[model samples]
Target: MIEEIRIQNLGVIGRAHVQLGPGLTVLTGETGAGKTMVLTALSLLLGGKADPATVRTQAQAAAVEGRVVLPADAPALVRAEEAGAELDDDGSLLLVRTVGAGGDGGSGRSRAFVGGRSVPQAVLGELAQALVTVHGQADQARLRSPAHQREALDAFVGPQHRETLGRYRTAWAERARVDTELTELVERAQDRSREAELLRLGLGEVERVDPQPGEDVALAEEAERLAHAEDLRAAASGAHAALTGDEDGGTDAVSAAAVVEHARRLLDQAGTHDPTLAALATRVAEAGYLLADASTELGAYLEDLQADPRRLEVVHQRRAELGTLTRSYGADVAQVLEWAAASGLRLLELEGGDQRIEELRATRDGLDASIAELARTLTLGRAEAAQRLADVVSQELTGLAMAGAQLQVVVEPADAPGPHGADRVEMLLVPHAGAPARPLGKGASGGELSRVMLALEVALATAPHDDEARPGTFVFDEVDAGVGGRAAIEIGRRLAELARGSQVLVVTHLAQVAAFGDRHLVVTKSTSDGVDVVTESDVRPVEGEDRVRELARMLSGQDDSQAARTHAAELLELSSVGR
Candidate 1:
């Protein structure tokens, strides 16, 4: 519940503080006394949009503040904590909004703070939704929308409908996902087929050639050696002739190995006289052995060398095949291998596309069956709730001087399922037994419509729903507009009855409504500094003689008149006795 509201530099209200409490509180004043500004101030505190034009002429900024009291475990407190708001020591929360004009031509900006902690303006808006519901002339207009009508009906149906709605929404979301998958798969069927054909062709070519890792590099080196086989054999034969005697050639006189052997023998024969010569002979003999081993290996290499054209042709053919694959796939053999690995995975997905489509379709069908059953249950629940709501609202209207008014909540099947359910709800009203039922807003006077809306709210409030806390405060701006006499009295009584359960505030010009107020406040205009120079609006609680005078002023536009004061006193007296 909102405990207090303060406004500074908002509209013509330079400064005003309204200390509020529980039950029905009424604000009344003469035309243009700025009684509406109090509601505006509360709206600002609730994160409503701020208009720079509403700022007082000489003020650089406009501000509104409010104190909201809630239980420790209330969802609002939870949300506030999530937003880093700190609660007061007494557990009450303070909300403030300031719109600064910068005292320049630049457009003004608004800021919000909750529980003394600065937060985004949107956070304030969220708390406001759970804290208050403000109804103005705009709300009466919104009641005409079918969408709003359905929402109202669902709210009236209580927690069962809310649960059903949650289930239906879950199914709807999953069905949407399945539909997306199915559409993608069906749309890309031809594309996948084309892609699969290309992959198969590439795989077939790779398989036919069956290229091995590192095989191409090894084959290139071998082909280069074979290409110069004749030159290689001649070079080895020359080296071997220098190492040992060449049997095929007579030009070579003595081989290196034979010369080294003679030197080693001379060294061995002189080693007995000089020990240094023995070490020299051993080194020469090792050099001679190395020369002989080199010649033997060189001769074997020349024998093994081949200059066959057939093998050379085969090597060139293999290189050409590998070149075709490398050019199509990658810059090198390694990169082509990577392409083959990745393409295999992609091909697997493409091949399974049809199977995936089948799986999604099956899942969607199963969900459809469940959703259809849930929709049926929701429709049944709505039909039952609608009947009870209409019956109770009719009973409430009878007390509000609308004895003949009949409210009908109609539920019919929708062409398709929605997030809420498969039913379309419409609230209809029958003025009397002979009259056909029409929509609530149609064929009804403004006063009659206001009573209907009030009755609906009362019915919804009295019934227990989910633990989700509703706004503890309700504000009505002239819902009694275009009303008078006994009907006005009934409206006042109903407002009081509503306040019995929660706080309610109203701005009114009717004395009958004002008389029912547990606390009466009056907004009066006065000039500051001098007469007729500058006017300001003042809001203050009225009691005793002052209350009677204000009520008299509302009753006959004459607070000083003897007859008006007497009537105002009588009205207050009767209202105190539940009139």
Candidate 2:
């Protein structure tokens, strides 16, 4: 709850410090006397919009600060710490906002701090959103939106729909996830099929070519031989002719083998006469045998040296096929083979799209079913709680001076599921008999709307919440504007009752309302010199004679009048708060 508020050079107030505690504290003053400035200060601390015009004429900047105490483990506390805010030793949070303008004619800029650390305004906004709700005429406009209506109804329903709301939220989240994945898969279906087809075509090409490892290198060597076949054959035949006489039978040439044979015969005839000559004959005979064996092998090679055009053509065709495979698939036959092996596994996975799609569809269908079930459950829970809420709030309205107010919590089905549920909840009002029932958004007056919200808050305070935690402060910035008489008194009573559980601060002009304040603060303007030379507005806590004087002034604009004093004294006696 807010412990204190400090304002410096804001609006008509030069400097003010308002100490607060847990209860209904009322701020009252004459028109334009700066009672609203106190609320403006608190609003600034709550991250409300900043206006340069709100700054005092003599001040360069306007600043508002608030001291709030929260649980140590609260989410706001954690976020403030994350933003590097230093918490008080007692775990209180310091919230501050300042709006400054340049000395020249320039627009103003604003800054915010949480727990004494400078932070973005948005961080302060988030913390304020969690801490307090400021209800006034502006918020009455917000009450007209259908989304807000649904939110109010949900909050009123409380723990009744917590479980089903949780389930619906989970199912809805899963549905979104599955839907996204399924959409992606379907969108890529054609692409995967095209990819699979290309893989199959490439693999088929490789299969048809059937190039073996190292085949390219081997084929290149074979092609070289075929290209120079005639040249090779000629060279071989010439060498053979030198060893033995050509097949053309040229007897004029003396062949190497024939000369060796003649030399051996001559040596043998001489070796018969002398033993040394016989040894020379044996050596010559060995030379003749070696020459004869080589000549025979050369003759066979010459016969086999002829090349065929058909064989060469076949080799060229095989080489061309291997070349095509090498260029498209890989630089070498081995690499191409490796690609084919990997492609086979990839192809299997790509074609498995159908199975994956089916699985997703199955999961999506199950999620759809679960979500529908949860929606139905949430709707039933809301329907039950809505009736109970209507009855309770209707009772509260009766005490707030609307005896004939009838509230109807309508649970209408939505065409599609929403984040909250499948139903759109609206609060309908029938002000009296013969008054047609209309949505509170359209039918209720400003006073009635205030009471409606107050009634809802009261009912919800008693209802169990999922966490059973309440906001730190309830700020009613003259939400009691259009209410009066007993109705105003009831509003005060309810506020005082609410303060029993949490902090309540109200800016009101009604004495009936101000009389119920546990602490009363009156904003008064002090004048200097004659006529309207200058004036200053000051706000401070008042009690005893000062409080009676303020209440008397609020009651009849006559603080010294005995009749007003007597009435104010009676009001004090009648008030429930200080009593």
For 1-579, candidate 1 gives per-residue lDDT tens digits of: 899888887776778888788899999988877777788888888878887777777678888889899987777778888898888888889999988765576358888999888999888888888888787767777776668888777887778778878888899899999999899899989999999999888877877877888878988998998899889888888888877777654436678888999999999999989999999999999998899899899989988888988999999999899888889987767777788888889999999998999999999999999899999988888888888989999999888887788998889988878877888888888877778999876777677777887887798788768657357788999988888888788888888988888799988999988889888888877777553111223678888899999989998999998999998898888685223
In terms of lDDT, the best-performing candidate is 1
Query: Top TM-score: which candidate number?
Result: 1
Tens-digit lDDT track of model 2 for 232-329: 77776776776786654444577878888898899899999998989999999999888888878878877876587787898899989987878988
lDDT of each: 0.84, 0.82
For candidate 2, the lDDT comes to 0.82
Clashes of 1: 0
The per-prediction tally of clashing pairs is 0, 0
What value does the lDDT take at residue 156 in candidate 2? Answer: 65
Off by over 4 Å in 1: 102-107, 202-342, 528-537, 577-579
Pairs in steric clash, model 1: none
